[model samples]
Target: MADPDGNVARAVKLETATISDALDRLGIVGQCYGIKGRDPDFRMAGRAFTMRCGPNSTPPGTVGDYIDDVPEGAVVVIDNHGRTDATIWGDILTEIAHRRRLAGTVIDGVSRDVHLCRTLGYPIFSLDHWMRTGKDRVQVEEMNCVVAIGGARVGPGDILVGDPDGVIVIPHEHEEAVLAAAEEIEAAEDSIRAAVRGGMRLDEARRQFKYHSLQTRKDAE
Candidate 1:
């Protein structure tokens, strides 16, 4: 029997592409589309703390009011309905999140004060950055619930792995299998490269490593 061993959070070198491949083999739709890193150089991995937002009510509402309650080392995942016109995050949140050692943040919509994030090296991934605020436009509807990011559904505590390529969620229930598959895929890919370096033809090296089927379903393998 397998269980999520917690190493995925510590394996900073695991690429989103490899994990995505693992998800594919496992038949899980964990790949996030459209949402991307605020800075291509930024990479992060952590369990999620999700927030969902909706249009403000007649009385108006606030954005990012629940940030203070988030615990350390959790990636703050926000769902803003994919709206790109307004922003839900900014410098103050970034400063605080950084000081608290939070893992990072990901938004289905836009974020503001990106300069601060870049300066602080605080990882943030979103549709884009804008100057307009969402204070009166969007309101937090819930916390730690299932939320959508780039068409992918993320629940509280799902493992979020992100990098220059993009973000991929590892559903909590499948993390162990996904991590095992990803590690295997990475090893096979590495072996192919090492074989080539030893003077083997690239095609021969790939054949030796069974590279094409590295991510094939285990049942089929």
Candidate 2:
């Protein structure tokens, strides 16, 4: 098993594409769908701190009021059942999350005040950006629990890597294997690129690196 902290550190150095390939090779489903970073330059990697939001109740529970409680460097992942009619994140949360040095925020729902997130260079990934607030429409029902984001299952402490491409979630129990596989995939792809740069034909380079099979599952091999 990889050291808990070390897995996060290592994952931070990898790209989601590589990690996604690794997950494929290991037969793990981690690639998220339809979620994207607010800014193309945004990138974030960290352990997840998940929250699940549901329809508001009487008096309407507060939304995103637990920002302060999230540990520094952890990604705040909110599962709002992919709601786009209302936003569960906004400027205030972006400001506080930036100041607190959170790794980033990921929402299965929409977010408002995207300008603040871009201005602060804070990473925010979501289904989309909308101005409608979720205050009366949604409320946090659980925290640090298993939640789904972009069709991927995310749980407390799961590794989340997000970039311009999107996000991928690695279960805590499989962090070590996932990280190792990602590293290998990345290295092989790097070599393939380098080979092509050094006068080798693309197909030959890919063949040499066995690029086509890099993401094939171990059991399949």
Candidate 3:
């Protein structure tokens, strides 16, 4: 895969808002809408291990069996078609993932027993939470494949950065460019803040840093 260590290390330090701005500047659609952390304190950054689920088959397939194969520092991304009625993740998976040192879990659907995740400090992001199980309701249809979560396309190994605000996906191919752009955006914002603190007018600080055009696509300019 990509240089997981270097990229993940860089990504973890950035806020999702900055990355989203960079993506916008690059004309990339990456914001994962409608997905937020179970707890506002939850945060994570790592490569994606994608999973997709659908209605159970004739004999029914399994859910969460692929957890064992996930590598450390990888984020488990489950796409359940935004089904809030059934839960495909629960406390047991949370405990295991925590113990296994996985970065976190993001579900397009809801997860049950959310208290355990909070107690363990294992970051879990989803649309919502419900208690009903998906044992025979939904089955894993694919693993390590391209999946859609929160209205964004997530391919296997895509970088996922999440914070209190939300999550954003960065395709591997755009990783380097996105990181560079995000860092630049962050630096400019930091400068603006410092200027404001130093008694400069807010409008003047923003103008000096070109904050208004920071997220404008280059080609569109």
Q: TM-score of every model?
A: 0.94, 0.96, 0.97
Candidate No. with top lDDT:
3
In model 2, the clashing pairs are: none
lDDT of 2 by residue, 1-221 (tens): 13356888898899999999999999988988999999999999888989999999998898977998998889999999999999999999999999998999999989999899999999999999999888888999999899999899999989899988899999989988999999999999999989999999999999999999999999999
Local accuracy of candidate 1 as per-residue lDDT tens digits, 28-132: 898889988888899988889999999889898777677778888889999998998889999999999999888899999999998999999999999899999
- Which window of 10 residues has the lowest lDDT sum in candidate 1? 1-10
User: Mind giving the per-residue lDDT tens digits that candidate 3 earns over 1-221?
Assistant: 24535988899899999999999999998999999999999999889999999999889889978888888889999999999989999998999999999999999999999899999999999999989999999999989899999889999999999999999999999999999999999999999999999999999999999999999999988
Clashes by residue pair, model 3: none
Candidate 1 Cα outliers beyond 4 Å, as residue runs: 1-4, 219-221
Per-model CA lDDT versus the true structure:
0.87, 0.91, 0.93
TM-score of 3: 0.97
Stretches of model 2 off by over 4 angstroms after superposition: 1-4
- Give each model's clash number: 0, 0, 0
